[model samples]
Target: MQKEIKAIIDGWRNYFQGSSSVGLTLAQERAVICSTCEYAKYGKHAAILPDAQIGNIQGYYCGVCKCPLSTAVRSSGYECPKNKW
Candidate 1:
């Protein structure tokens, strides 16, 4: 049990050390609109609604509301202009 715990700790330390690369979820990378739900207000769905990919946008869904959210709205950083379509 001690060895297992030590191994886990070492793995975490390595991850943080930047010796290896770590992937980020849409929520963590700021690539997706919604990190909790699936409701995309501007489009049929926010980019990367299901799976989060590096170099690609991610979508978040609201577990409570079951709706997709825009990162801009969630973060309150910036509001992208609505698409004409």
Candidate 2:
């Protein structure tokens, strides 16, 4: 719970500071890790409903920490609860 709050705060800080949270290469690397993780869920199982207006991005979600993979990977300060990334 504390970690989640910290991650959210850091994300907001990065946004307000106009800072790049994570590089594309690093984010991709993290994505790879997430793809093979047992705790990862995709499509509807990820609990991310499609938003037709936004092109219906099917994002991944973590079963453990319950954070969206897209947001988690992009947050430089975010550490995987299981220390996978």
Candidate 3:
């Protein structure tokens, strides 16, 4: 829980600092890790909105912490909860 909060805060801080995201290669690497993670859930059904079809539903997310994997992976300072990245 604390980690999630810290990640969010850091994300916001980075955003305001004008350098929030990582390079494409690093982000892609993180994506690959998140995609294969057991705790990473794909699709909207995993988020409990079975009827909705959000664009990011196709992206992966951490099932345990409920953080959006796409956004999380793009943030260089963010770390995986399970250390998969």
Candidate 4:
């Protein structure tokens, strides 16, 4: 019985993963970085990622903006970063 239930759960998880939207656009990704930028606390709203320069954002920033960023991503038709499993 436990194995059967686990199989059903695994199937649903896989289905959702395949059907979900992911990733980000250049502009939106920048906005994401800005909102969480470390400099944001000191009044900076610009995204200055030196590595990728201009692409999908994936790095450290203010934890304060995590919730809002997650919401924005969801509203923009993408899955939350924490839900990518």
* CA shift of 58, model 1, Å: 13
- Model-by-model lDDT, in order? 0.33, 0.63, 0.59, 0.35
Summarize candidate 3's per-residue lDDT along 2-83 as a digit string, tens digits. Answer: 7667776665454345444676566666666776678877755444422122233335567976766655665666777788
lDDT of 1 by residue, 1-85 (tens): 6654443444334323423122233224443333222333334444443332322323433343333333232222222233211
TM-score leaderboard ranking: 2, 3, 1, 4
Per-residue C-alpha lDDT of model 4 across residues 1-85, encoded as one tens digit per residue: 6654443344334323432123334335544655455533322212332223222232333344332232233232323344422
The segments of candidate 1 whose C-alpha lies over 4 angstroms from its true place after superposition are 20-85
Quote the lDDT for 83 in model 4.
42
**Candidates 2 and 4, the one with greater lDDT:** 2
Q: Where is the poorest 10-residue window by lDDT in model 2?
A: 49-58
Q: Residue 38 CA error for candidate 2 (Å)? A: 0.6
Report the C-alpha displacement of residue 28, candidate 1, in angstroms.
22
TM-score of each: 0.24, 0.64, 0.60, 0.22
Candidate number with greatest TM-score: 2
Cα-based lDDT at residue 55, candidate 3: 33
What would you estimate as the lDDT of candidate 4?
Answer: 0.35
Of candidate 1, the 10-residue stretch with the lowest lDDT total is: 76-85
lDDT at 57, model 3: 30
List per-candidate RMSD values in Å.
Answer: 14.9, 5.2, 6.0, 11.5
